[model samples]
Target: MLTALNNPRPAMLAVFMLLGGSVAAAASPTITVSWRDKPPYHYLDNGVPKGFLLERTQAIFAAAGIATRLAPEPQKRIWANFSHGATNYCSFSWYRLPEREAVGQYTLPISIDPPHSVLVSGAALARVKTHATLAALLADQELTLGVVDGVSYGPELDAMIAHSANQMMRRTVDTTSMMRMLSVGRASIMLVDREDWEYVHRHEPILQSTTRLDFPDMPPGLKRYIVCSRDISPLVMDKINQAITATGGAVRSSHGTEEERKAHQRP
Candidate 1:
């Protein structure tokens, strides 16, 4: 049974009616949640939507007595759709930014943990350590860093990357592909969330031999949240936040190690 954020059945409608007077009372309000392929966060496996963040979102909405459809959309299209009010949707595990807030609302802090280190093959790890500051990191013309295309890492980082004339070479469509590229020496380093990296490392053979270069003292990780369109009612946002809070603030991994947890907890 695939979960959808659009198709509401009669039984679901009946349940909503029974719970009428709540914010979910609006005629089968189906929120088209935006999703992208970020493993251990949001991804499809054997045709089933399975990920920590996606499952947590579903659980949160269910707890709030809200029936929503979880539809997967491309990152850019999802933002565009929500911005135009063409859909009442939200995305799981998104970094909150001022530009995004102008067009959408956010659930309470999902993960305050900073992003983990960029996992690179052993050969590439040797090169990244040579660069100290971000400027030095960017100045290395020989290096090819990989970042997910639509991810935001706050304003300062965004500005820095935006101003960099040769930043395009550092971008990739998804993390898994980026990791593969790193393994094959197609790219030097792949930037990814620490928890996510471990998840992949445990499950994917290609990543098992890779080396993780943690910027423990540097700004690498991003605090993430669930975000919905600004057009969504304040009542809806409140319900979502209530559900998130009730669920203990964020998603708990079913398969994370103590080290990964500690790394995520690091400022």
Candidate 2:
């Protein structure tokens, strides 16, 4: 007859289904994954989210059997969310900074960025080229260095820039705007990410008048990881790390054309 107490399985199943949908739905907790607007990496395209890193992140969560809601937020808001210990919140593709460690737990590397290069205006190229190494160029107090406020040029460069004697002009702007500033000679030079340089160079004619110089003193590319608030569970982080191992972290070709992007997708 399978009375209520004798056979609680059916009742439990019904309650589970009623509460959520199925066992899977109840077991899988959904988290909000946030990212800043850094195109060809992670950004909004005409209101729809797009980016190789975003796609790769989606794939990692799916492979880990986790549920995620993609959220595009400003850089400041993203950090603020982590600082306040927002439950089940995560941000993608950030450098594993020492100061940031206090706010969030980092998963295994999610992406790797190529080393930074110097973007010099035509008026500054000759002076910039005179220096044999990045150190020498940064030490030049005569040159004004344009930096994006609150951004890291990776650990090595960040340290160098902090101690550099050069004149500084810092702004809170995107790479495109920074490139424009360089074109107008607002600053003599700026450190640029290789991927950002490629994307901006193709779209901005101003780059044609500028130069991208790589230096021997430049550090190797930096590895980026998915950082989550303290409230996110260890189980979830383990799954993410396993997924990162299964799929070689998300560094894909950043130079794909729009047609190619439309044709290709990760399986």
Candidate 3:
């Protein structure tokens, strides 16, 4: 070994580091992945990726002899990197939106959630109590709706929001903040997954009195999927498809815990 005094040149050190990385990667070339923090599905647990979706996804990839490494990052960066082909990563717990599908490859359905549920404070609910359906509720312009900015609430809901964009209040953040808007009546109503609403409600006392509005006209629960960068090789995706088939399906279990179904009720 060279003595401590005999330092390597910077250029040589960089080349050596590059060679070391290549050698290490050849033995185990893991795909780096990440997704936004959407609770009860995917999120970072103590700075490490630890959701049920991660476990299920990892299991499928592992069984296919493919490994993955987590690169926790913001949601926007996930798409940006993929779009530029700067990196190859797959996002979890995504929904099938035509706009997104045009830009990336999507995996099979990850989970079938109940229809996006509308939420309103107890008092707000009473105002629209007679309006029992989505159409009727939308006709009443007195109440403003809340939504997370840039989120696609399914095609049908997206159309609805577009129709009432003037009456819609959007937050440039997660649904948790939108829920808060409903709690204080700053926003009269909001749309979210029943499971997601309940999860956030449990933690935010301001939302304790929130009620789910019944919308018979709404489509069935949204189908969650993983939208991968278009640049990902077909072989890797084919393997994932086979893994999905082998694992039965990606919607194996809810991820609030190892046994979330037993722990939380279907809302």
Please provide TM-scores, in order, for all candidate models, with all chains considered together: 0.77, 0.84, 0.79
Clashing pairs in 1: 4-69, 4-70, 5-69, 5-70, 6-69, 114-221, 115-221, 115-222
* lDDT: the better of candidates 1 and 2: 2
For candidate 3, the per-residue lDDT at 221 reads 71
Q: Over 4 Å off in model 3, which ranges?
A: 1-28, 250-267
| Cα lDDT of model 2 by residue, 1-267, tens digit | 458689999889889777774466457768999999887788887899988888899999888878899989888889988887799898898998998999999999987776677888989988887898889999999999999987887888888989999999999988778989998999999998767777777877877888777787789888888999897778779989999889886564453466643332111
Q: For residues 45-119, could you state the per-residue lDDT of candidate 1 as single tens digits?
A: 998898877887788888776778877777888778767876577787777787688888888977654444656
Report how far off residue 176 is in candidate 2 (Å).
2.0
Question: What would you estimate as the lDDT of candidate 3?
Answer: 0.72
> How many pairs of residues collide in model 3?
0
Question: What is candidate 3's lDDT per residue for 1-267, written digit by digit as tens?
Answer: 365337757667888999996676476546777777776566665876676666777777766666677666767777677667754667777778766777789877766677676787766777767776777777778888887887778888888877763377877887777787788888878877767776787777878777765466777777777667777788778877788778767463342453543332222
lDDT of 2: 0.83
Candidate 3 — which pairs collide? Answer: none
For candidate 1, give the lDDT of residue 146. 66
User: lDDT values of the candidates?
Assistant: 0.69, 0.83, 0.72
**By TM-score: ranked, best first:** 2, 3, 1
